[model samples]
Target: MGRGGPREIVQLTGDRDAISSVTFLADGKTLASGGGGMVWLWDVSYLVKPLSFLCAQVGRSFTQEEWERYVPEGPAYRKIC
Candidate 1:
């Protein structure tokens, strides 16, 4: 049903108000969120495989130099994709 990993079902923008509530449907994959006097639904079944989702969005993994900037004292960068 999906490529796997976590995939963003939708991106909400232009709403100045904060979210008021949220509920997950019985199926577990459907989610409902309310805000700004409106309700939005999302399908979250793709979250089972987060790596695939991230790889698909970025098309490439982080480079050593870039990773070092965030984890300067951590282990060497390893490509995830």
Candidate 2:
């Protein structure tokens, strides 16, 4: 997420072409970015993994349990503990 400053915690770069529109789906985990010739739907729920920053730097993918543990909910984000 991008804060008030120039610093951005998450940098989502998928569209190779110029982006025209960006919108978040009702679930808030799905992001739709449109531009150029095609539209891209990104599932941001994957970012909820614990040690996300470290994992990203090492090019690692988190298992479902990891995301659930860190997100306080579960992989589905229902969050009932």
Candidate 3:
């Protein structure tokens, strides 16, 4: 998208083999990918506000030291909640 050919907004990992197909369901919030004789369904609605969703699930933001250790070049830490 945009000037680039395509962009990656999020990554869904843990597949054991190469993904052969992908499709969005009629609801548009669900994504399906198939490979390795299996099909996986993903709830993609959270992509709209992934940070908020993650913060809710994790229940806490990274500490300043943790942020600095993980994202040395990132901007100053801010509470995601």
Candidate 4:
């Protein structure tokens, strides 16, 4: 939303973190995740492009034009930055 809610969509799965439970909150925008003695709350909202989100977390931002140079065009991929 324009008000600035969660701005990213992240995929978390049992194969990755061993999630034991999942449920949506009554508001419908929030999700609860549980696994390994931890509970995580997530809010769904408009998301930035994947590359842009990564760049921001590391203290920078990239436009789509900039991202094209570093990302491959197809299934070929690189795992580390």
User: TM-score for all predictions?
Assistant: 0.44, 0.45, 0.51, 0.37
lDDT for 41 (candidate 4): 79
lDDT of 4: 0.57
Runs in model 2 lying further than 4 Å from the true structure: 1-6, 47-81
lDDT by residue (tens digit), candidate 1, 1-81: 445556554575534375788898888877788887788787776665644565677799867777677445445667878
Model 3 compared with the native: what TM-score? 0.51
In TM-score terms, candidate 2 sits at: 0.45
Q: Write the per-residue lDDT of candidate 2 for residues 3-64, one digit (tens) a residue.
A: 34454346787755678898988887788888877888887875555455446654755456
Backbone-clash count (model 3): 0
Quick one: ranking by TM-score, best first? Answer: 3, 2, 1, 4
Q: Distance from true position, residue 13, model 4, in Å?
A: 8.3
Best by lDDT: 3
- What are the lDDT scores of the predictions, listed in order? 0.68, 0.63, 0.76, 0.57
Model 1 score (lDDT) = 0.68
Residue pairs with backbone overlap in model 4: none
Residue range with the least summed lDDT across 10 consecutive positions in model 3: 1-10
Q: Report the error of model 2 at residue 65, Å.
A: 24
lDDT by residue (tens digit), candidate 4, 1-81: 543455433575444465788888787767788888888877653232454455556565444555566543422443323
Which candidate's TM-score is highest?
A: 3
